[model samples]
Target chain A: AQSVTQLDSQVPVFEEAPVELRCNYSSSVSVYLFWYVQYPNQGLQLLLKYLSGSTLVKGINGFEAEFNKSQTSFHLRKPSVHISDTAEYFCAVTPTGFQKLVFGTGTRLLVSP
Target chain B: EAGVAQSPRYKIIEKRQSVAFWCNPISGHATLYWYQQILGQGPKLLIQFQNNGVVDDSQLPKDRFSAERLKGVDSTLKIQPAKLEDSAVYLCASSVGLAGGPPRETQYFGPGTRLLVL
Candidate 1:
């Protein structure tokens, strides 16, 4: 019963442009993908993960995410963005062995300048 | 190193009163977590611990919520009576191993505690 679907609640991008923060998931089994980054008050950090190797996944400050598994999706890219990169972005799912995670309802990232 | 530790970063209480929150982890981290963010949503896993027992708390809300980690590296989370949807933001995380294993560890957060149940 996993679920996550961040279709962008807000994304104002501008500091250097180039951003993408969309995510989708539904999982029936076999899953483990993440991307987190809260900033305002803090708590939540870990910007890359896709356990099981190689679907892109780059994380940390530079940010990157791919893992498309037939379009279940896991988007979160950033070719150029700064202004501190703003914050608030989440998309999680866990089901491989279940560490329990199923989030997705965030995507602020308002980095203007 | 020194990452997960939370305690009253902010609180405002007012609906039926009663509140408590505290956490400290990341020194070997045997796994610990408690989340509940809700100001826009995303972060919800009320309880989970593996060092002091309790593998998962289902969804936590046992009557009015309550948590404890006793000796597994400090932890507490109580919320009797309060409800304004319980306000939000109460993260605390840690990770190292031992909970169904396989080494996927990566959960280190803590700078949250903003509860305003008015």
Candidate 2:
């Protein structure tokens, strides 16, 4: 079984400021990592994924994440944020051969003006 | 491409009542999944289907929840005698079910059905 942990339950940042949401996972086998975002009353949208190679993965809305295998972390980062970036973020993991994803509780990012 | 679709954007029911939700996966998608998301929590996989056959359902509360995919296209999930804890958002997701394929890792999700049990 696989599990994900998001250290922060909520984060507040001013517009144009940088931010990082921490995520860590536990699994016995190799796994794939992903970050997803959900706006109020909307479904989740994929931010980025780390299947293999190039630990630094770029995603939409100028967001990126670094996959640190040794640390078992896949933290999402953004150099600059906007008010519209406020949303709920989730970190998910699945084993190499399976598609069942285990997700973190969530991190609510509130980008303020 | 059209994304996954789920019906009844919102539903409210009393305890001990029955409720059903429907889902339509993306065209050409072979894998469908049902997930439950409690308030302020991440979505948890309840069941997964690969072309009308169940691939995984280890987390589902089988005593009160049941789901089915017919003709490998659409699916329905039913809960009998709903409990207060059953109040949550039900999400439907779909992905290509090819083993050992690259893009199979991505799963598109629907808007989800919000169920509020009183």
Candidate 3:
């Protein structure tokens, strides 16, 4: 079975500041990684995904993540954040041959003015 | 394109009562999934359907929770004799199915139904 870990429960940052949400996974086989964001009352929206190419994956809203195989990490980063970027972020993974998507607890990004 | 759709944004029911939630996947999506999300936790897949056929349901509480995706488009999930622990958000998501890709297809999600068990 595959599992995801998001060490930080919450990350507070000011507007226009850089931020990074850490994520790690454990899997016996190769896997795919993804980052999703959820607004207050909406469902999750895909921020980006890492399937097979380019360890550095860029996503919408100026967000990006790096797939570090040796470190088993896929950390999401943004050069600058806006107040509207405040939302719950999630990291998910699925094995190369499986269909089940395992998600981390979540990291709430709180952006202040 | 329209995303996944779910009905009854919020529902309140007492323990031992029954309630049901509805979901409609994207027009051409062949795979649908139902997930339960507790407060402060990530969503957990309770059941998965591939064109009206059961694909995986190992985590579902079969004794009280049941779900069906009829016609391979719309689906309904029901919980009988609800428990206080059942108070959580129920999310519905859909993907292009195995034919599109394996472990790579993006799963679009719905607004989710918030169930409150008192």
Candidate 4:
């Protein structure tokens, strides 16, 4: 089984400021990592995923995450954020051969003007 | 193509009452999933269906929760004699399934059904 941990529960940033949401995971086997964003009362949308080949993966809405195997971390980062970027983000992990994903408690991002 | 759809965006019920949530997966998709998301937490997978059969339901609380996919198109999830702890958002997701390996395909989700137990 795989599990994920998001370090921050809430993050507040000003518009145009850079932000990073930290995520770490524990899995005994090879894993696939993903980041998803959820707006208020809405379903989650895929941000990006780290399956293989590249450690740095980019996704929609100018978001990117890096997979560090040694650290077991897949932290999401954006060079500049917008008010529309404010939402809840979740990190998830699925083992190499598993179909289901185990998710981390979401981190709320509040981008202010 | 339309995204996944769910019914009864919100519902309120007293303890011990029964409630059901419905989901319609995207066209041509062969895999479906249901998850329970409690406040202040991430969504937890309750069950997974490949076509009209069960895939993985190890985490499901069998005594209180049951789900089915009829005709492999629409699915329904029910909770019997609900408890206060059962108040949460129920999410439905679907993905395309291929042969010969794990279904590593990306999934699309529907706006969840929020349930409140009083």
Top candidate (lDDT)? 3
What tens digits encode model 1's per-residue C-alpha lDDT throughout B6-117? 9989999899889999998889888888999889989999888888888889999899989999898879999999989889889989888664662266788899899988
Among all windows of 10 consecutive residues in model 3 chain B, the one with the lowest summed lDDT is B98-107
Q: Looking at candidate 1, what TM-score does chain B attain?
A: 0.33
lDDT of 2: 0.94
- Candidate 3 per-residue lDDT, tens place, B46-78, comes to 999999999889999999999998799999999
CA lDDT of each candidate? Answer: 0.87, 0.94, 0.95, 0.93
Show how many residue pairs clash in every candidate, following the order shown. 0, 0, 0, 0
Task: List runs of model 2 lying over 4 Å from the truth.
Answer: B101-104
Worst 10 residues of 4 chain A by lDDT: A94-103
Q: Which is the winner by lDDT between candidate 1 and candidate 3?
A: 3
TM-scores of the candidates are: 0.34, 0.97, 0.98, 0.98
Q: Write the per-residue lDDT of candidate 1 for residues A29-113, one digit (tens) a residue.
A: 8898888888899898888888887899887888899998998898989899999989888988888877788789888989889
TM match of model 4 to true structure: 0.98
For A12-81, candidate 4 gives per-residue lDDT tens digits of: 9999999999999999999989899999999999999988998999999999999999999999999999
Quality class of the docking in candidate 3, CAPRI style: high
Task: Please provide, for model 2 over A4-41, each residue's C-alpha lDDT reduced to its tens digit, 9 standing for 90 to 100.
Answer: 99999999999999999999999889989999999999
lDDT of 2 by residue, B18-102 (tens): 9999999999888899999999899999999989999899999999999999899999999998999999999999888786642
What is the total number of backbone clashes in candidate 4? Answer: 0
| Sort by lDDT, top down from the best | 3, 2, 4, 1
Candidate 1 chain A: worst 10 consecutive residues by lDDT? A93-102
